[model samples]
Target: MAKKKATAKAADNLTFLKTPTGINGLDEITLGGFPKGRPTLICGAAGCGKTLFSLEFLVKGVEEFNEPGVFIAFEEKADELALNVTSLGFDLKKLQDEKKLRIDYIHIDKSEIEETGEYDLQGLFIRLGYAIDSIGAKRVVLDTIENLFSGLTNEGILRAELRRLFQFLKDKGVTAIITGESGEKTLTRQGLEEYVSDCVILLDHRVVNQISTRRLRIIKYRGSLHGTNEYPFLIDEDGISVLPVTSLKLDKPVSAEIINSGIPSLDKMFPTGGFYKGSSILTSGTAGTGKTSIAVSFADAACKRGEKCLYFAFEESPAQIIRNMKSIDLNLQKHVDKGLLKFYASRPTMYGLEMHLVAIHKAIQKFKPNVVVLDPITNLITIGSFSEVKSMLVRMIDFLQENQITVMFTALTLSTVINDQTDDGVSSLVDSWLCIKDIEMNGERNRGLYVMKARGMQHSNQIREFVITNKGLSLVDVYLGPDGILTGSARETQMLMEETGQVLHRNALGRKDREVLRKRKLLEAKIESLKTEFESAEEELNKIYIEDEIKRGVLNKTRQQMTDLRSGNKDI
Candidate 1:
């Protein structure tokens, strides 16, 4: 099954022969890379990274692909070019010394060009060809092609030279990149140059809200499919990195496994015990509702399980986050020291949303983390509009889920109205939405946590008390008072009142039982006494009857004496 997916993954590159531009994320955008043995045009405004993009392509080719490259500069000197790239860790001096690279700075004097009365590339082609042959280079770059059109008055001659320059690179069988200044109406200053190139890329530098961002778009690629969307690229110490959009198919392999929410009670809320692997989770709440606590718990859990976690903090510094988490007994610094957790903190206004997304994409690709946390994504809305933030989040979630990495991001709900609705910021894009809201009553604000939705699992509908103690984060069952589900101090107060009422009820029941026993004992004593008195009276009555019987017998005996005298003759 995996083999089939792998084959399908490579199907996009099967249509053509290409040379890989080893810049991060560029190969995926081009599906294979630039077209082989063809000149590609990169046109952008000044300081838009057109030159760095080409230099990175050449340097990466030489270092990674073992392809020697020649860079022919027309705007800067060879030493200046080499010095400017040293910050990117490109050892140009060493590469040139090893004969693996060549840099030729062709001085283009506009005055000399006007005096010469011609715009031609034969002499320049000879030098470029000699440099390529000297190092057996397979890659070439012509930085700032606008210099060739500096003083040209005849459009036909400039057009012819542009065709010859591209044809020369193609004839030499080397994949070439030519950088040019963006024209007001066309892709390059020389409007006809883009027509002759096999591929044309446009770099854009846009500033929104005083924050600058760099974007790259592929205008056209002949005979090979390429992404036409504007991809965000970042230039750090390593060099240019373009964050390519995914294949845009929902064909990523799914996992049946479930991972915990790092809080045991929160995991118990779901029937599967936690979130599904690679699921996107959104934890949203008002201020001080423990949203960051949830993120910290997840990072701590991932690190505890020996899995890497990347935490992107847009508000606090790394040390501040670490110290804040420590109050909850979560030692994040230990995870940092162990290299299992990484924190990337940047202000939301540091750059446009696209560049932040690029940084996130680059960081995830480099760290290969098992999970990621974007603490409070609502801060991103300050830099971009709501739709732009949502769009950026859509792309970010797509990238994360495609990698099968679990992501738990927090969103702040600033609305004062308490309702059943979750903060709808990116809520539609997540697989699970954990809505935490403030239940303010009894002069205190308490957190009530409930699962708004958890896809593919049975989850609890009842809200729980989202507790954050010094030991850690936990969820306890909220109280059901007369008013309804009670939380925080009100819930505790209700519990105490009910406990006191139960104690009083038990004591009353015990006292009533004792009194009933005492009354029953008194009644039994009275019955015993009455029985003794009745027995004594019956004995006295019997004795009187015996005495009366004796008296009657004596009287009868007197009478019987006379009668007996008569009867005695027969029976004395």
Candidate 2:
């Protein structure tokens, strides 16, 4: 009975302790790293960053937590391991000099070993135990346990020895990381290693469209809560950082701060001046409907207010965007020069969806922008399937909202009309949706803009006509004239025709009045000239009559004289 009580007491004291994973965003996903004083299995195919993860854990423990660590490499030499991690900012040589870190490389050569009938891994344990005790290490890493399988041909002995090695590490009370290569069918090549470990994490490296992405997922963790989602991780100079996306919950209270949408008219449409600071806005439209222009305008407005903004251009280069905006008079170069805006342009197929998320997260953390804009999120579909891209976007939007960052994502909707409720639709997940489309009106296609939905705020329901001109984008209020809401170039033509008709009518009436007045004046002048000519002709006729009368008198006088001379001759 005394011995039973002692056993119970020992079991009670064996409460599972938790270890902190030095990687940012990882501890949150696993509740708190791994089970302390227990060996955890990290299995992955070659070049999946399993060794880098283990190194990060050890380096973080020593640097941040002030806990000493022991690293046992079964495959790589000490100098080789040190060189591999130098880019991650880990100085193994420096840590070794401080006596706080210990690195042991077990050089195993199958040719040098004699084929014994039976063998135990106790000798390896003795060396690891000595190193752990010597530095009082709280963290330990055994990289690539599958290397032992290559050296040992006895499967029965390898399995038993692997179990015993894990048990020995648990007995030593050190948090250990044991990495193994993935098997063809099982979680690990040596399947027994996963069962003996307290937790199992799987890493995957895949190339899609010639772009590589590293993904991490927690397969199982005994006696602790863990995130079930596969997260995207990145390897850079600072080591591996996994982007944990499971913490998106809307239960938290929202802020009442009214943030401008960069568009004054758009803000006026919202009751709260604009969207809530952390609200997500989705701008979806057909091709050539001006989604990127709208997103850029939003970013410009944010930068104009002195709020930092980040623009991720997936479809267009920075120079191309700047040149395009020049036509609309939106100068982005000045904002970039002022450091109020940052532009990151890359091809959508440059990396997988997860890598894109990691890059955005890292940029956000570094720039701490108040607003983030992704110009055409649909471009990411090239790397992932529709469902995968949607899932990734949901997580990304959730992450942005948690940090109170206003994110605007532009997507190209293939359909002529997009409904708020539908499969593979982003409208349902977004806090606000602004839809732009081409509407057939008056024998021509015209751009139409509307607010499909804006939660927790009052917005305009009217469909506004959008025009792009040299000055920039303008929203024309719907005309309430006899011809309801004139649209397209036809409306402008009608307006011009009406204006030209009124001017022509006025000119025609003016010309008629002038003609009437000029005709009256000419008639009066002609009558005066004819009256003077008639009076002169009568005077000349009277004068000629007088002269004719005078000539006739003379002729009569001559005739009478001739008659008298003839009469005298007759009488003689």
Candidate 3:
């Protein structure tokens, strides 16, 4: 008895089991997925993707989890539902034929049921239970609850029936999704549906400035924690993909790895020799400052390293960018041909900001690129305000960094307040900020590139002369001449003048050395002549002295003995 009690207590204490929906990024925000063996409410207005959401949950169960699902439609028949989902690449017919999926259409006459005062889901339970048992299904979806109870206006019967339906699904041990229309103030048309469901998700579709955006928010999760932010979702040829905004945390792993900035000279400006891996780089500049060139160069560098790069072009087509970069000696077509580079070009007006973000998120997930570039993000301003754009970018950067994907955005700066605000707002969120501006000097405008900020690394403080030539983008040190800092023709002129002065000074020094050499030779010749004359004089004096000594000796000998001295002298 004690063992039985302990076992029962353990089962009660165990966390609720969750069934993964298998939709990209949906399970992340749902914090595992919908509750297993319980119904989840997916409420939204018409065309807000409630049905698609439920269908995806069912299809993904079979596809990813090996769990068959039964989709019960109250509005559309099985054939209609199948045809509707065909475009999303869902092979519903094949799944049905293979017994992996089952579809049932529920029909009701609202007028007749109301006249008869008969409204109950007892028959629904029998039918749904049989379907679940037939395929041994683990997932179920009710395309809509509004049509199921359209004949009933009494709140008490609706509440009881809704509760009963939820309990029936729970008894069957199958996870279920129930769709509903949006109410005026509440999340669903049946105001109390959110209160009973284990999980309640709200979908919203709104148009601002004529651009439509679809967002999803979790209103309530009875026994689990979930993201509360309105995550943007995308519906394209692939199906539904939700971009979880608040799912990423600040503690995501970081890398000390370095990646090149495409330009060798520019990389030299950073102490790390390149940008940090997974870092966000913002290149902001005015018109004609070669911002796109910097982005393209970065992409090329990544592709050259045998890594994939995704380029999102807002102002130019892939062909246009490739053609223009060729002038600078960068061959981007090879990377594209090698499948290392992919380009997605679209105008900012193509969709709302959130849609753009979802599209980018989808592309990144599909391509799994190591590098991403958004050329001229300034074009996004046409669709949304600065704050909205900034918010979208923050979400995007957080997502990218969480995945350890390096991203670079190029922003066009102008003298007006709009461009300034855009750059200022975005620059703060980036890991590195490279500002390129025109430096008007020497009757010509030259580009000056400088690093405004680079987190976690040392960078150059001096503004470098940014030049675009046949060899691609390069940075050169600004010339320090008599005229402060100089670039372009002024720098060249100062260098030329300094070189000329150095040549003249060398020539003058050489002339002085030659003159000194000539003077030393002349002085040596004069000294030698004087020494020869002195030696001659000394020899003559010595000869005279010897003669005097001999004469004195002869006189003394003559005085002593004339004959004897003369004989001695003759003998000497």
Which of the numbered candidates is closest to the native, going by highest TM-score?
A: 1
Candidates 1 and 2 compared by lDDT, better number: 1
Q: Give the C-alpha miss distance for residue 134 in model 3, angstroms.
A: 2.0
Estimate the lDDT of model 2: 0.84
User: Candidate 2 has which clashing residue pairs, if any?
Assistant: none
Give the runs in model 1 whose Cα sits over 4 Å from its true position. 1-15, 110-121, 151-159, 192-195, 418-425, 524-572
Clashes of each: 0, 0, 0
lDDT of 3 by residue, 7-47 (tens): 64476468767889998888898889998778888988899
Clashes by residue pair, model 1 = none
Give each prediction's root-mean-square deviation over alpha carbons: 5.4, 12.3, 5.2
**Cα deviation of 132, candidate 3, in Å:** 2.2
TM-scores for all candidates? 0.88, 0.79, 0.84
Worst 10 residues of 1 by lDDT: 416-425
Which ten residues in a row are the worst by lDDT in model 2? 417-426
Model 2 alpha-carbon drift over 4 Å, by segment: 1-15, 116-122, 153-160, 206-213, 417-424, 440-445, 480-484, 497-572
Q: What is the alpha-carbon lDDT for the whole of candidate 3? A: 0.87
Stretches > 4 Å off in candidate 3:
1-13, 109-121, 149-162, 192-195, 416-422, 503-572
> C-alpha displacement of 244 in model 2, angstroms?
2.7
TM-score of decoy 1:
0.88
